[model samples]
Target: MELDNIDFQILWLLTENSRIQWKDLGEQIHMTGQAVGNRIKKLEDNGVIKAYSLIVDEMKVGLSYTAFILIYMKTSNHNSFIQFINEQNEVVEAHRISGEGCYHLKVKIHSQEKLNLFLNEILEYGNYSVSLSINEIKQRNPLIATI
Candidate 1:
């Protein structure tokens, strides 16, 4: 569906705070609560907005390391690898992409030892190259960039 400016505005606002009341969201976009609700419903039905998520502070959660892994699958069988990632708590995000790598994973760990253990386990499916994040510069909703 082609989205109008108001739809984009609603999406942008929701990305900032999904918990914002429909009335409050409407206020920002100069619409009524019912109107905003209707727009949100349509967006949901169209799958433009998948789900709401919580942002956890890694420091508060005792998670110290943030690592991005570029996976090179060892074989054609990927079901096992997908299942392995799903079972691991540290893998926050995983994606199959059309680029230099087969898969990309974003994970958080507590220490070097933990990171090493995770990397070693990954060898069951494939060899991986990892980049550790020393400091997070920015993390914004990707939709914000398009808007």
Candidate 2:
């Protein structure tokens, strides 16, 4: 779908707070609530808006440790390893890459002991190098205008 300035404006506002009421959003863009809703529905139908997500405080949730693991596979077959990571709840993100390793994973766990146990489980598939995050500087979605 082709998005005009109005559609971009709607997206910009939605990005700031997804829960904003349609009428309030319409007031901001100088349109009726029904019109705004129509545009939003079309955006969803065309797959412009995939899903709404929440940002949680890891420290508050008891997910205190963030680890990045680079996996070097022992063999060429990767199907089993891929399935393993997919089933592990601690793994938040996984990527297949072209450089030093076969895959890179971002994981969150409650403690160091849990991290060690997770690493041991990973050894069946491959060797890994892990790094724990000291602090998170920034985490955000891309601005609508940039898109």
Candidate 3:
């Protein structure tokens, strides 16, 4: 669990390109491929590296609309609402927060009509305020930021 400079370097390289071969990564960091693999496996086992992700172009994939929804619950019970969010494929990211709302949701849909339908479905659980994103300026890599 204690990460040294080498581990940080490996994390930084992995964040830049997760699919890079272990040997190539080792070459960059001056280590053997097998050693790098052992470190990576350790990271995974320790829950430092949770999962590998793919970044897709949403527009090209027909997911043109990105909406941020702030949900204000009508009732104290949240299980039903949580289940609804879990079942909705459009709800890409969901977080429970303390502030102006009970929950925050990041949603992606293909069209305005679908967005409208999604919003209507949400009314069953709570009232929501929606904001549409015109552009994404930056997607921060936490490893790069920390290292």
Best by lDDT: 3
Clashes of 3: 0
User: What is the C-alpha lDDT profile of model 3 across 35-96, one tens digit per residue?
Assistant: 99999999999999999998998889999999999999999999999999999999999999
Better of 2 and 3 by TM-score: 3
Please list all clashing residue pairs in model 2, or write none if there are none: none
lDDT of 2 by residue, 1-147 (tens): 889989899999999899999999999999999999999999999999998877788899999999999999999999999999999999999999999999999999999999999999999999999999999997766865465
Task: Tell me the deviation in Å of residue 143 in model 2.
Answer: 4.4
Please list all clashing residue pairs in model 3, or write none if there are none: none
Error of 2 at 66 (Å): 0.6
Candidates in order have lDDT scores of 0.94, 0.94, 0.95
The worst-scoring run of ten residues by lDDT in candidate 2 lies at: 138-147
> How well does candidate 2 score on lDDT at residue 13?
91
Alpha carbon deviation, residue 14, candidate 1 (Å):
0.7
lDDT of 1 by residue, 1-147 (tens): 999999999999998899999999999889999999999999999999999988888899889999999999999989999999999999999999788879999999898899999999999889899999989988877899888
Q: Model 1 segments beyond 4 Å from truth?
A: 98-100
